[model samples]
Target chain A: MALLDVRDLSVTFSDHHGRRRVVDGLSYSLDAGGSLAIVGESGSGKTQSALALMGLCGPTADVGGSVRLDGRELLGLPWPALQQIRGQRIAMVFQDPMTSLNPYRRIGGQMTEMLTLRKGLSADAARTECLEMLEAVQIGDPSNRFTQFPHELSGGIRQRVMIAIALLGRPDLLVADEPTTALDVTVQAQILRLLADLRRAMGMATLLITHDLGLVAGLCDEVLVMYAGRPAEQGPVDDVFARSLHPYTRGLLHSVPRLGRDPGRAPPARLQAITGSPPAAGDAGPGCAFAPRCAYRFGPCDEKQPEFAAVAGSRRVACHLESPP
Target chain B: MTLLGVEDIDVVYPGRSRKDMPVRAVDGVSLTVDAGQTLGIVGESGCGKSSLARALIGLAPLSRGEFRLGDSIVRAGERRWPRRLREEIQMVFQDPVSALDPRMPAWQIVAEPLAIHRPELNAGQRRERSMAMLDRVGLTADLAMRYPHQFSGGQCQRIAIARALVVEPRLLICDEAVSALDVSVQAQIVNLLAGLQDELDLAILFISHDLAVVHHLSQRVAVMYLGQVVESGTREQVYGLPAHPYTRALLAAIPDPARLELPAVLDGEVPSPTDPPGGCRFRTRCPHAIALCAKSPPPAVAVNGHHAACHRRDELTRPAPG
Candidate 1:
């Protein structure tokens, strides 16, 4: 069995407006000690998918899926049972470290709480491990840094602290959502290296969620491109980067500016812009979500909702253009 | 002559605590911009690029250097400004939402620049100018009455661009203007800025922390490090063949889709400016650091058209100190 298998996951939100399925027929499996990256623009439901995996859904949102982590069903697991495994079995590091951490709590207190409460470490042992965790993330002067508040640290440092907190439990899975978006390129490199080293040391399965294709190309082992609310494409990072079939994926890769190009040169050619705004979740009909902007779209793509189909080796695209199954 | 000339300006942020020393944000940095061109100011956070851009526009107080627009020197460190000095330089801040007042509608925000500069113009003429600027930025006049929260980050950026252009200023300083937007939005804003540069024929000082963005938008690029211009050259010279070790590592660090084969060079996080290294600020992390790097600062060495300040400028150095 895969380390974490999410099969045919569907989540819908409802209000006085109507029923809207934001995540439609999403499915993927992560192996132990492997890494997968989800790349998409904002409102593409990356964070929402993460939340579903955590078994944290809203009252009006209906979730139908199979989520298994290490042979345990995670979707229908009870709250108390899920909480028992939340920090210890599957940890998560959110995007914004500044807002994720509490302003009033000291860094040591947060780190120690996770260790003592989740890992069953004693107070004294937790304290030692807390310092060790801080040192592991390469924070200079861990002893003094433990007493500092979130505001006292820089964005990069706070993010490192967050990583330390998540790694304290030594969870099998680590889900990082845009961990480096708020940082500069220099600091971003440091954070990416730190994550890579930690993952290797702990042998953890990582799900890196980000909008930057550059970082995806450098760090991720597998790439899953999300568009609208579905997986537009998935493949090995090298393969996907080499041959991006979906128009949305193609547009995203082209949008990133490259170095060494003349500044005054005309901007790189943008493929057909995915022309219209993202379709509302409730308004999704029986058609490819990207049909409105796709240059190769046809009647079949508009008449029926496209499903996942294999293209070349280890690559899958959700479009009718892929030679019929 | 360049449209805007900044002659070796030093900007110092006032000290906050009694024991705290005054922070030299922009220390003796100089650059010049001609009409229909762009000069990109790039550096890590706290490297004083924003301070330098603000000082050039009379927003940030300049402790020493003077700014001359055409032949007139715009006075620094004061709210009151001469009419000619005020209209010649305009600034676009990082946050479009806050830089533009939230309570008022978009039209008035764009009209405020004209109001302050050309008070004698009639309402009809001002409205016409505001709509023209909006159209030039690819924004419809219908978006004029909408509040800031109603628009996307990209559209709000376009509004900010329109506001800065209505005065018909000779210079526009953009400080991390596109950093907050999404990728699609960032591309749109970048293209819009490039298009506006052609239409208005204005000189722009674009400040950003992203090297790729700077490489795409600048005619001439100046890399700053701890309040100093560590490297400066044309886009081709700096991005094509970087001289400074920092510039080389920074260029290598940019992850391009076409070139994923090159190994990354930059390693540790950028150190804070409050307590930088003693001699050469980048020596602690310089790959080719020598013993002399600890004793004295490296001087700028001109290689062809590019300039870099490194003790070992000839050698191709990585990010890690050997």
Candidate 2:
């Protein structure tokens, strides 16, 4: 069995205006020690889908469908059961370390809380383990860092602390949502390297959520491109990024500014930007959500939502085109 | 011709208490931006590129060095910038939504610069220019009256761009202007900036942490580290054969899918600006640091029209000649 199986997952939010499904018909599976990345622009439901996985969505959110781990269903579990599963089985690290880490508490105190409470380790043992995990993340002078607050450390160090704390529970799965978006390129690279190393050492499956396609290739084995709460494409990172099938995916690939190998060559005068912005949450019509922005959009695109069907290899695409463009 | 020439610019922030030493956010850095060109300044956070931007605009304290804009030379400790100089330099900030006034409509926000600097123009003329600028930035006249909250993030950014360009500034300092926007929106804005640079012959000091975006827009590039220009050259020179260890590591760090291998990340964090390392600020994290690198700051060595501030620049680039 796969380490994680999410099938037909949907998330909706209701208000006086009525109900809108922010995430719809998302399905993917990850093997043990595998890494998968969910890439999309804002309001694509990438973050919402990950939130639905952890049951971390706000009270206004209504999540449906199935999420299974090791042959066990997790969609409708009670709060107490879900709480036990949270830090013990699946840990999460957010983008902004300053916001994620408690400012009022010391680093050592925060790191050991998970171990002492959930793992039933004594205070001394948890401290020693936390120090080791900090070292594992390659933080220098782990003892000095332990006593300091989150604000005392630099942005990179604070993020490392977050990773150390997340790994303290030694969860089988690590869900990182835009973990390096707030950091500088060099610092982001360091964080990505650390994550890759930890995954190798711990054999943990990772569900990485990010908008940058550039970031997906190195760390992730699989890629799932999301658009307006639907799966636009999915396949091996190298294969899918090498030749994206979906029109939306292609547009995104062209939109990003890449550092060309031939640096002496002049950059293109203009990026082939998708002319229109993404549809707002709950604003997608009955037809394809990305049809308005798609260059190869056709008659069938406006009439009905295309089915997510298989393409060559492990790739799947949700577009009306008869073959890959 | 050089539209802006910065010479040994420094921005130091006084500490909160006597015990805390003042932070030298921007150590003596110098560069030039030519007319109708983009000088891309790239570095990680706290590298002082933003401080340089603010110092250029007279927002930050210019502790040392002077900047030459055309024939006029503005020295450090100038209390107020000349009115004409102020109009010649405009800025577009990172967060588009928050940068705009929530209460004001898009048209007024665009015209606010005109009202401040171009007072001779009547309200109608300002409105006319505002609509034209809005159109130039891909925003429609219909949305001009709408408040910031009504527009999307991209649209708000368009409004911000309109405001900056409405006055027709010669130099536009974009400090991470597109960093907050989504990739698609960022492309639109980037294209708009490029198009405008040609149309108005604007000189842009584009500062961003993302190297790819900087590589795309800039003709000349300067790599900053802890408030100093570690390397500066044409886009082709710097991106093609980065001499400085920091520059090479930075370029290698970009997670480009076209590249086969994973990025080679530098170890350790940027030391606190309050108390930087004795000689080189980057030596703590630099992979090619030598014993001499710890004694004194490396001087800039010109290599094929590119300048790198490293003691062993030639040795590192040409470890073994062909």
Candidate 3:
């Protein structure tokens, strides 16, 4: 059985413009020790979908549909029940470490408090565990760093501390939302490798949400490509990248400049840029959300939304032009 | 003479008080940009790429050295830039939304440069020029009345580019100009810049952290590390045969889906600039660092017209192990 199964999860916010659905009928599942990535551009509802699954969407958001963890329904759970599952069952690594961490408290103090409160460990026991967790995340001289505040450390170090704190409860699943976006390329590589290593060492599943398709290819086992809050394509990373069925996915690949082209060969005269921007939330109207920008958009794509259907082996794509042979 | 020639330029932020150490933001950097050519300055954050760009435009005071734009020689420590120099060089900043004024409409913002530099032009002429510039940047004249908030990121960036070019500056200094835009939008801006450069015969000092974007747009590339140009060559030489370890690591670090092979990751964070290491600034994180690297800075060596500041440049540039 899958460790986390999401069925038609939708997140809507009620404003003066009525209820606008930002994440519309998103569904995916991750088995124990599996990694899945949700790839999309800004305003694609990638972050909101992850928030909905974690029940972290605040009071204004109305999350619907079923989120089953180990075959237990998570939707409509009370505050106390959701709180218990939050850190203990699933943890999250946010985008910016500076804002996510408490600026006033020392790193050790934060970790110890969480350990004592969540795990019922004694104060002394929590201190020991905190030190171990810091070392586990590869922070050298944890004893010295334990007393330092978040501002005292560099951006890269602070991110590592955030990862350690998230894994303190030994959650079964970890959801990282653009964890490396704020970092430099060298620091980003370190963080990615650390996440991969820690995930494997702890035998936990990962739900990585990012905008970079290259990062998805490197870190994820499977990928769910979202376009304007809808899943455009989903399959194994290698298979999907090798032969993407959706025009949106292909467009994204074509736009990014790949490194290490032949030295003397000129780069493409011009990039094949997607012409239009994504639609506003709840304003996609009746047809396919990506039809405005999709090069292969057809008549049905303009008239009706295409449902996700099986394509080539183990892949599913939502496009009017795609069908299984 | 080169269109823009910078010789050993340095920018230092003096210590606020006795206790604080001076921060050398840009140290002894030199490069040239020919007419209708783009010289890309690539580096990670805090490596002083932006500071160098600021120095070139007189925003940051250069501590030493000299730079020439066309026939004029601008020395360090000049309190005020000449009007001719200011009119000849323009800059486009990274943040499109913040860079533009909230109260001003797109047309007024684009016309402001002309209003200040060319007071002889009447209001109608300024308006007509602004509309023409907007049209050149692919923004229709009808949208000129809209404010920055009304426009998307890409549209706002186009407006910014139009403003920078309306003065008809010979040199354009763009510091991470398209970094804030989406990938598709970024490509559009890049293509627009390339087109404009050719049409106007402008020289560009393009500073960005993105290696691929730099490679695509630049004719020559300079890799900066710890406020110094670690390597510089034609785009082909720098990208094809990087001589500096830092440059090689940076190129390798790019997440290329076509090349799934893992990059030879450089360990540790960039060292603090205020209290940089004794010798080579990147020695702490360099994979090929030796005892000599910690004793003295490496001198620049020329290899097939490429200049790299590394003690082990030859060995590092050799064909990689399988």
| Candidate 1 lDDT, A1-325, residue by residue in tens | 7999998888889888778788877888999999999887777877788888887776677888888888788887788898987878888998899999999999999889997877688999999998999999999999999899999999989999999999988899999999988887777878887888888899999999998888876667898988777899999888788778787788766666765345334435332233434554536677887888677888898899888777777888898874421
Residue A183 in model 3: lDDT: 93
Give the TM-score comparing model 2 with the true structure, all chains together.
Answer: 0.98
DockQ top scorer:
2
Q: In every candidate, what fraction of the native interface contacts is reproduced?
A: 0.36, 0.70, 0.43
Which is better, 1 or 2, measured by TM-score?
2
Q: In lDDT terms, how accurate is model 2?
A: 0.90
Model 1, residue pairs in steric clash: none
Every prediction's TM-score for the first chain? 0.94, 0.99, 0.97
List candidate 3 segments past 4 Å from native: A261-264, A322-325, B319-322
Task: Please report the candidate that would top lDDT against the real structure.
Answer: 2
In the range B169-264, model 1's lDDT, one tens digit per residue, is 888889999887777667777877887788778888899988878877888999998999999988887776677878877776776656554237
Separate DockQ for every predicted complex: 0.37, 0.73, 0.62
lDDT (Cα, 0-100) at B259 in candidate 1: 51
Q: Write the per-residue lDDT of candidate 3 for residues B1-322, one digit (tens) a residue.
A: 3899999999999899999999999999988888889999999999999999998888887999999888788888877667888988999999999999999999999999998999999999999999999999988877999999999898999999999999999999999998988766787788889889889999899999988888888999999998899999998889887889898788778887665544447789898888888778889989899998999999888877799999887776778799
Compare candidates 1 and 2 on DockQ and give the better one.
Answer: 2
lDDT of 1 at A275: 41
For each candidate, give its TM-score against the true structure.
0.92, 0.98, 0.98
